[model samples]
Target: MNFVLKTILEEVRIRVFWILICFSFTWFTCYWFSEEFIFLLAKPFLTLPYLDSSFICTQLTEALSTYVTTSLISCFYFLFPFLSYQIWCFLMPSCYEEQRKKYNKLFYLSGFCFFLFFFVTFIWIVPNVWHFLYKLSTTSTNLLIIKLQPKIFDYIMLTVRILFISSICSQVPVLVICLLESKGVKTFIKNRRFFIVFSLFTAALFTPPDIWCQIVVCLPIYLIIELTIFYALIIQVYKRQLAL
Candidate 1:
């Protein structure tokens, strides 16, 4: 048993060492091209009317720090699939056949959902949210000019936060399906109204204070819950027929 444990530990160490090396290489590559990542992030903000395409840095270290932070985040985003595969390889040895199959399906589904919402946030939600905030600045009267002079670090941080939130939100369907599988479809149907309200509340918490933003976030969650329920019900009916 001691020898077995030692072997497992050695394997884990080796896997971790390799993963770290890959991560370091990816981080360095991302850092080298950090400006491109920043530009992609700032594209929506740049497209807004009356706003200059430049961000200002107040502190001397702000720009450097922001570049490093952006590179780290971009590295993580780009390396997620490889990291997930490594994780699966580490865990697969211990899982039973059925559990392995479930984990495999979940890994792919979750990755797909995460990237889908990440792009959605980048292409649609971020632009709309920025546009809405920009509109607020347009309410300036002749006497008072309310121009938006965005700081470099703050803009990048806010965009990162929104993207992170959207990626997490993408797991709603996977979570709902897991719950349905555990609790059964009938219970979910019985508590469907509660889930709807909960999703709305969650959306409100994550999205900006705009109604449209909240709706945009909430609608997808609502659809996920309903679809999970529908899928679960079909599976249950199919199982019953097979049993008969």
Candidate 2:
């Protein structure tokens, strides 16, 4: 028992040390190319009429804060898979063989879906969202020149928030599968209206205050939920076939 405890402690310490190293590497790497990343994130706004392609920092330290925040997020993004793997390693020793197999697949799948959704949101959805917001900002009284220069902190935070929301939301399917039994999943699938309402509410909670953003984000979330149901059904079928 003492040996087991010692082993666990050693593993935890090693994983923590590696995590710190990876974070340091990622932080410096992101800082090195901060300008390019900032430009890429703000690229969508370039096409907008009343907005400059640059972000403004109202406070002297806001730029530093934004840069550090961006670097930290980038570090987290790189570290998530390693962290998840370490967590899985720590937990898997207690799991049965079948459970371990299922969990391992689910872990990788969750990671894949997370990054996939984040990239899609960051690359495709964000640009369109910015375009819509910029257009909406110019709706009434086009005579006045209203420049839309978002603060650096606000812009970076918004970008990070959207990415984080999308990544976590994408893991919904895997989490549902892992936490619930097949019967529970079937029941969840049957409640379409409830899920739709839940999705909208969740989107509203995560997205900007605008109704349009909520609606737009809600659609994909609902779709992912439905796909999760199908995924659950498929897993059930696969399991039954294996039993035979």
State the lDDT of candidate 2 residue by residue for 85-173, as single tens digits. Answer: 77887899989999899888888888888888988897788887777766765536667866677787887788777887888688877
lDDT of each: 0.87, 0.78
Q: Model 2, residue 226: displacement in angstroms?
A: 2.4
Instruction: Please report the candidate that would top TM-score against the real structure.
Output: 1
Candidate 2 residue pairs in clash (backbone atoms < 3 Å)? none
- lDDT of model number 1: 0.87
Q: Write the per-residue lDDT of candidate 1 for residues 86-105, one digit (tens) a residue.
A: 88898999999999999888
Predicted structure 1, TM vs. truth? 0.83
Candidate 2, which ten residues in sequence have the lowest lDDT sum? 44-53
Model 2 stretches astray by more than 4 angstroms: 47-51, 139-142, 180-183, 189-201, 210-212, 234-244
